[model samples]
Target: MGEPNEVAFRLTRRHSSVPRARAMLHAALGDWSVGQDALDESELVLSELVTNALRVRVPGDRQVGVRILLLPDERLVRLEVSDAGAGKPQIQHPCEDETGGRGLMLVEALAHRWGVEERVGGIGKTVWAELKAQFVVPAPAPPVEVPAAMVRPGQCVRVWGCWRTALGVRGDLDADGALHVVIELDEGPPLRVRSREPLTVREAGTPAAHEAAEPTPG
Candidate 1:
């Protein structure tokens, strides 16, 4: 959407920090408009990193640090988890009989690329991963204008502050013979507008509106 942004937080070194880390990562990536699949993968990667960070032999008072960055232009998302532990994390290949030591394996499979680096203060290490981001672009604005009377089913109209498909339209004359137009939308309730009121509408098959055209009223 706009420029890239970063979010950082610290979590207590405990088993509870795993889900909390995932929640914060989800919130940050969701705000960046990341796709569902990417969000899922990113959360899994973060969970593994945080879990490994928690297992590090650090002091009780030392906390785990997490950082998330989204680069819209590059279509990339980066995750980092740091701990004040002594040793570096290495990917392990455990036998089938072993039920553990698979965290890094999952990270390697899910992330685009991953590695470790020494913490800035040199007291600990930071595990980082980068994942491809799926960003959905908004549809373009409507170009063609259609009059309310000419509006037909399967067309798109901007009413109630949203773009909705036109389900049906009809005009009725009141006791005074003043014409009132009723337009039905695919979502929400119908709309009733006076014949003279302005309406925002677009023909079918436009970029902003991709509804299949229906037969016009006889």
Candidate 2:
């Protein structure tokens, strides 16, 4: 059986933090099998939530934070942002050129459901959103057979990709963003990488793209 379907990521304000969040999500959830529409929606939500935290943070204390949770069995994913500022965020339908508004409204229009609440007994507040989907798991692939010589270095085949968790890609990203990739390709400890943002794989390389796998799982 697979491990628990719940995972959490906590972070402070940093330039690379947002992309790390996205990459971590993609890794933990097994390639984000999300379709074109869903993928676009998820990315937009992440952007809005993170950007809000950045813009409205308390300057003196500088303790702004973000958390992402995925509840796969329940068919929902949640994004939450918490900051020292106690001001309640409103989802205003602002005019086209309102100096600084429209974040919450965009979230409301996109999320299946979203709301704001006090952070338990805390001083800050958490603006959050939840999205649900009729997500389906892919059928397991049949085995492959090939010559040992064809496999090369640094290759990530599906069988291998499934079990590995990566924090980030080494060369793909610039200084602004990083990734926190987690995979379950095997029963190994989840890898927590801090990587530069690389171009996301529209499709992971082909079977022949990288090194071939050993006959058995790593």
Candidate 3:
């Protein structure tokens, strides 16, 4: 169960659960801003899975469980339906005149991968399908920080009466265009401090001296 990104619920064995499951999928993927074509495909796969689960010969008292999970890395959407049925599902090729038995076929055609797995610690099975999807909103990139050359990574700087080795540098420009360098220090635990004032810095084994502030480009 992925917090804030997954939806899981149990539904009674009824036809109405199918639409409710589709609505849940739409709400989840819609918040992620997935592409329409991908959303449509996900909805179709979900519908088939839920419908098939409802048809299984589970005890009348047992309910079907539905889970929708979205993976941002591969832009993948997954659907799972669980029921206490006694058999695995197999895809079938029906004659053109047959009006039914094409649910698994449609799922195999639309989903990148589909399979059945034993329900964990339960007397049932879970059928899952994964589809490659496209996100309308792209994932955010990591922040890139500009480096300040005056204080190199290998230099040592005095902070609070102790000399800490500078591990890295990051720069930021103020609203008034003033330059500030954020120095990452290797104390007991890693620490960071902004250099907005004059400070003493030097090589690892050398005497400390004041170095003129250098500007970091935006």
TM-score of each: 0.67, 0.55, 0.61
1-218: candidate 2 lDDT, tens digit per residue: 32325446565677676787667656644454544465556667877787777676576546555666565565666777777677887877767777767777778888989888888877778888887644545643333443222222333323434512222222223366653333322345533333321211212333333333443323
| Candidate with better lDDT, 1 vs 3 | 1
Encode model 3's per-residue lDDT on 77-196: one tens digit a residue. Answer: 888999999899999899999999999999999999999999999989999999998979544332222234367787766666667788887776777877777777886544333444
**C-alpha lDDT of candidate 3 relative to the true structure:** 0.79
Selected candidate, larger TM-score, 1 vs 2: 1
- Model 2 regions lying over 4 Å from their true place: 1-4, 31-36, 98-100, 134-136, 143-218
Question: For model 3, which pairs clash?
Answer: none
Ordered by TM-score, highest first, the candidates read 1, 3, 2
Clash number for candidate 2: 18
Tens digit of lDDT per residue, candidate 1, span 29-111?
88888999999999999999999988888789999999999977779999999999877788999999999999999999999
CA lDDT of each prediction against the hidden true structure: 0.84, 0.56, 0.79
Candidate 1 runs further than 4 Å off = 1-3, 138-198, 201-218
How do the candidates rank by lDDT, highest first? 1, 3, 2
After superposition on all C-alphas, the RMSD of every candidate to the true structure, in Å, is 8.3, 16.3, 11.5
For model 3 the local lDDT of residue 214 reads 36
Highest lDDT, which number? Answer: 1
lDDT of 1 at 177: 88
RMSD of 3: 11.5
lDDT of 1 at 143: 40
